[model samples]
Every structure is written in C-alpha cells, then in structure tokens.
Target: MTKTIKTVSFAAAAILVVIICTFLIIRQTHENVLSKETVVKKVEASYEGKVTKATQSKDKKTYDITLENPKGTYFVKADAISADILSMNRVKAVNPSAMTEKEAEHLALERVPGTVKKQTRQSQVATYTIQKEDGKTYEVKVDMQAKTVLSADQISSKDQQKTPITKKEAKTIAERKTGGTADDADLEESEGTLIFEVDVDLPDNKEATVKINAYTGKVANIVYED
Candidate 1:
C-alpha cells in the first residue's frame, strides 16, 4: 500500500510542474504581443503610404488600418501577434469626372430649394445635406459623373417656429467665437434643435466649421480641418 501511494504522489507532482511551465510560457508570450504602433509601422513600411487611421479589433487579435496615398485609400487587416497582413483592399480612388463641390452645391440647391447645411464627400460619393425654409432637412445624393440628383430624402423635420436669432447674428457670433473670417452661414436643424452652420477661415490656411444654437446664440461645436 505504501509503495502504491508514493507512485501516485509522484505522478501528481509531475502534472503540477507541467501546468506551471505552460502558464509561464503563456505569460511571456502575452507580454511580447505586438502593439498597435508597431503593427501600423509594419503596414506602412510594406504598403508605402500614410496611415490615416488604425483600430484594433474588440478581441484584440487583429488591426484595421486605413492608408492613403497617391494610388488611393486602402484598408488593411493585419495579425496582432505576428504583424502579418491578412488582407488588403482599396476603398476609394479619385474620380476624374466627378463634379466639383460648387457644382454639386448649385445642383442640390436647384433641386431642393434650400440652404446647404453640410457636405459628405468621399472620392466619388457625394452628398449634400440641405435645410429648406419649412424646417425640413433633406439629404441629396448626386451622381458623380452625370451631375444629376440621384435621390433626395427628408431626414428630419423640426417644429415650425420663428428663430429668435437672425442669420447675420449667427455669422457674427461664429466669427467672434473663432476669431476667423466667416465665409458662409446656414440655418439648419440638428436633432430637433435649430442651429446655424458657419464656415470660417483662419489666418494660417486652417478652416473651421462652427455650429451655433439658433435660438440662444450659443456656440454648440467647432471642428477644425487642415
């Protein structure tokens, strides 16, 4: 009976040793896992472009990177541990026959008969967010090459009431807040609130988009662009 007990004890010790060794190896491997910066560098080196954005997956197993170059915009997925690219795809390229921003704005106004509130443009995809006089916001998608309005959808309609602040007052408030030159201003509704969207130009070639509350004349948000 004593000899059998000794053999069983030895087997249990060996199993515990194996488990401890496995745990140590895993800990070291986790410590050596690649970082997001290293993965971005590896992709930029291999892909030859400027990295616009890099994001890690929720599982922390892979990375999604956006790169922009003269060739176009590319989306690349790479392994987190080995920094190996799993897939690559070009998402956008410049369209030679695409309509200019001014052209799109003009066409959109002709179709919708409102002030241009915002512009969503990426490569060949162009859209104008417009606000009509009746407090209804419409999104107008235009054909890139054909210069025609593809679709116009009413996104939101605010309660109809006379805005307390005039358009000129909103422009003055935006310029005062930004200390820049106000180029254009438009009154629009955002999330059931009346607001003014103003474009301003700074001194050093920087631009700003300012949103002011139309009722109270308060600046809501400002976004700067290079």
Candidate 2:
C-alpha cells in the first residue's frame, strides 16, 4: 500500500509539470500575436482622437483608421513600418472609395493612353504618372468615387493650360510674327490663364517666345531671350 501511494504521487507530479509547460508555451504565443488595439492606441496618441474605428487589410497587412468624426478619418499605408497619413502631399481634393485600382487604371489609360509609369493613391484619389512618347511627363488624377478623371496636369509646371489653338497653328503664327522657325510649341499656363507658347529661333540668332490666348486664339504676349 505504501509503494502504490508513492507511485501515484510521482505520476501526479509529472502530469502537473507537463500542464505547466504547455500553459507557458501557449501564453508566450499569445503575447507574440500582433494586436490591433495596441496599434490604435499608438495612433490615438499622435492624432488626439479616440480611434472609434480601426481596420486591417485583408492580408493582415496594415490598418485603416477612423475617428468619431467623418472628416477626421484617415488611412494607413500597408507595410512593415505602418505609417498613417493625415494629409497627403500635393494631392487635390477628390472623393475616396470611388473605384477599384483596375478601374482607375483603365480610366487613366483611356484618358492619357501613354506609358503607365506609376500608379499610387494620393489622399483619396487614384493618381497616375504617365510618360508620353514625346518625352513629356503628366500627372492624372482620378476620383474613384466620382468615377471620373478630376484633373490632368504637366508635373513640372502648373503654368500651362489647354489651348484651342493647335501646336502647328501656334508654331506657324510664331514663325510668321518673328520671321523665325519654331524650336518647340506647347500649351502653358501664364498668370491666371492658359496660353499657347511657341519658341522660335530667328536668323539673327535670337530666341523668342510667342504667347497666344488659349480661348480667344489671339496673340497674348511675347518675350525675347536676351
């Protein structure tokens, strides 16, 4: 009887040890799990909001954040570092949640139809940077919610606008006025208006710019390089 009691006690001690080891392993795993609540708390510290809403990407990549106010909502870029954007740089006003990426790409291609160099989300807009065959780069903004291209502009200069006068016409007019041939012609924005600007090289080795009104199709201004 004494031997049996001793054997039973030894078996109980071994079982208890196994149970404690398993519990420790499970606790470690739980501690290692990524917590959304922790990330939200971190963001709330920076943005000064209650973080009323929070979401993770489908692949468990990044988090999308929303405050109590509708306008106070923001998005987090999905990745390892996980950065949230309160405001996007150089982005225009547009509707978010307009369309899918594929739809935006298709719309951009239909509108610009050039080399699709880059695609990114700016603020809430689907922004695409395209390079043309003529070596000109343009930025196209698509409002996914509105399902339309909001604006297209040359990346370098907001100083240009669409003109009714064609490039060929502008060049011809510039050459006739300056007695020179066109080096190049482009529609550019000057001041608050759009103008057709033609660069001409004269026989006197002078370079001149002829500006034509985009709407009126008349000579607007000219500047000669000194």
Candidate 3:
C-alpha cells in the first residue's frame, strides 16, 4: 500500500513540472511576436521633408531623397513598409516664399549680370557676391520660389558715373580689361564708375568675402568673416 502511494505522488509531481514548462514556452513565444509587430508598424509611417528627387533602390526596398536649402540628402529603407507623402519638393512647410537652391541660383544669374563671384543659399534665398572685370563688387539677392530678383546693388565705392549702364555692356567691358574671365565679375551701378571685385579669403580663416564694382566689372575687396 505504501509503495502504491509513493508511485502516485511521483506521477503527480511529473505532471506539474510539464505544465509549468509548457506555460513558460508559450509566454516567451507571444512576447517575441508582439515585439516584431511593433517594429513593423513604425517602419510604415511616412517621413516628410524637402524632396528634390526620389529614386527607389534596385531592390525596391529603399528610397533616397535630396533636400534643398542646406543641400542635404538622405536614404530611407522602405521594404515591407508604407508611407504617405503630404507634399513633395517643397522647401518649407507653410511659407511658399521658401525657395530651393537651384531656383535661387537661376534667379541670381538672370538678375545680377556679372559672373557669380560667390553664391550661397540661405533660408531659401540665393545671396550672390559678384565681381566685374572693371574692379567692382556687388551684392545681389534672388528669391528662388518667386523667381524674382530681390536686390541688386554695387558695393560702396568712390567712382560716380551716372550714365545708365546696361548689365550686358558692363560685363563685356569688365571682362576684357580685367585680364580675367568674365565669369568672375558682378557688373552693377555704384557711385558712378563701373567696378569689379573678386572673392578674397582673409588670413585668419578659409572663409571668403566677395568684392565687386556696382557700375563696372571690377573686383576691389573681399573680406572674409567667420
């Protein structure tokens, strides 16, 4: 009778161990499944920014986007994921005045006449410091989104010649006399004489400031700051 009782007790203990093991295995499996599902959901959400161009990878699992303003680009993985684009190719979210770097460059070239001495895109506008062959420098601003010239004026100079000078004529003359390519000058009107300036780097740092004449295509000064 005692032997039978002992046998029964052993049987019960074995059953309990099996039950506990099974429960643990099932819980671990469920947790792993939940974790995987969460990760998948996050990948399906859309990311918005200024998209210059979008190209799907050959595997069709990734997308590369180029942004404007700071001229930055990024790549995102898109495999087994979904995304919705609210807007594309926009420089900013609310302001339509925001412009892309390429657009700003075009506007500056059209309005400012002289060769681009130094051109930079900041906050959607293209700021150009131009130098003409005649020894003058000018500062010009172009709005990329509006496709309009914001401002065009020669740097401070002593020359004063008030005869209306066409941008084309000024460029040609500056190029010939400067013994340099016309592409380096910004031709505009100043005190009166045509001027040209060029980009110059200060001894302190690699930064450059462009100088040009307002009337003639002459580069006079370039002070680099920061």
Candidate 4:
C-alpha cells in the first residue's frame, strides 16, 4: 500500500510539470506571431528610414524589407518569431551622377515652356506644375537621374476638380509643421480614407513623413526619423 501511494504521487507531479511546460510553449508561440504592421514599424525603427518594400518568407517565419533614405538603399531581414535583426546590408548608394533639382527644372521648362508653380520629387522623377503666361497650367515629369523629359500634359479644367487639398498644399503644411524641405508627395488610401503623404528632409540627415487627411486637410500622422 505504501509503494502504490508513492507511485501515484510521482505520476501526478510529472503530469503537473508537463502541463506547465505545454502552457509556456503555447504562450510563446502566440506572442511571437507579430502582425505585419508591427513588423514594419520595427523595421523602420531599426533602419531609421522608409520601408519601400516588404515581403515575408514562405513559412511566414521571416520578413525582408527594403529601406531607402538620402544615404542609400538597404536590404533588411528579421526573424518573425523573435523579431530579431537577422541581417542588414546596404544595396545601393545615392547616385552621384543624378541631376540636380535645378537641372531637372531646366529640362521640365524646356518641355513645357512655362513658369514652375510647384515642383516635387517622387522616386527618380521630378514633377513640375508649370503655368503659362496665358494662365494655362501643365504638368511635366522629368527623369532626374537620366536628365530626360518623361511627359508634359496640359492640366484640364476637369483635372482641377481635385480633393479638398492639393499635393502642393500638403507639402506646405508638412514643411511648416516640421521646418524641413518637403521632398516627395503622394496620395494614398489607408483604411478606406484618402491621405496625402509628404516626405520631408530635415537637417542632420533626419527625415519626417507627414500624412494629412484629404477631406479635411488635417494632419493625420507624422513619422520622424533620426
């Protein structure tokens, strides 16, 4: 009878240990399954720049992202389960041969022959909103890197019917708020709402990305990098 009692106690203790270990494993797995947005935020924080592209592994256990800043472009990989930086490498540097803003402006003016009302850079292209002497407006796109004219389209009256705010207006708001140069402007949809995203270049190699509401022209969000 004594032996049987001792055996039963030992088995119960073993079962309890197994249960606790199983619980811990389950909790860890759940915690490691991070959301895509969370992973993106982590990558941006680590790289101190904008993530231009992101992709996940087939097993969803790893994430790869491409980050870009004034300095250059970088490729980053992190473990999804641990959120650890597996590796980061710079893929490209800023092109030294890229044409300057003034040179691009010249190309645009030669294409449209108008006074530049507003100019913005997006990717490798410089876009200009030029107004003619007769009050006509045109949109011109120039390849800043190649120093070539991409397109020159007349701004129709119908095209003037835009959202509550214009890209130029958004850039102005961002620059005023951050005291930086607005480099790029784009319109994007987030959660079924339209927002204008403006990238601002600050001193000391810092940068800020400002998002403004399209309907109300209010600032929606600002992500700053240092």
Top-TM-score candidate index: 1
Across 96-199, the per-residue lDDT of candidate 1 in tens digits comes to: 56688888889888889998866777766588878899978788888768778989888733421333466787888888998999999998988998999999
Q: How much lDDT does candidate 3 score?
A: 0.53
Ranking by lDDT: 4, 1, 2, 3
Structural similarity to truth (TM-score) of each candidate: 0.36, 0.28, 0.27, 0.34
User: Model 4, 32-114: lDDT tens per residue?
Assistant: 77776788898888767898888888767788888898889999888887668899899998865889899999989887887
Worst 10 residues of 2 by lDDT: 86-95
Model 4 per-residue lDDT at 126: 93
C-alpha lDDT of all candidate models, in order: 0.84, 0.71, 0.53, 0.86
lDDT tens digits, residue span 130-162, model 3 = 766786777788877677888988876643233
Off by over 4 Å in 4: 1-96, 163-226
Off by over 4 Å in 1: 52-61, 68-74, 90-97, 100-226
Q: Tell me the TM-score of model 4.
A: 0.34
| Model with the higher TM-score, candidate 2 or 3 | 2
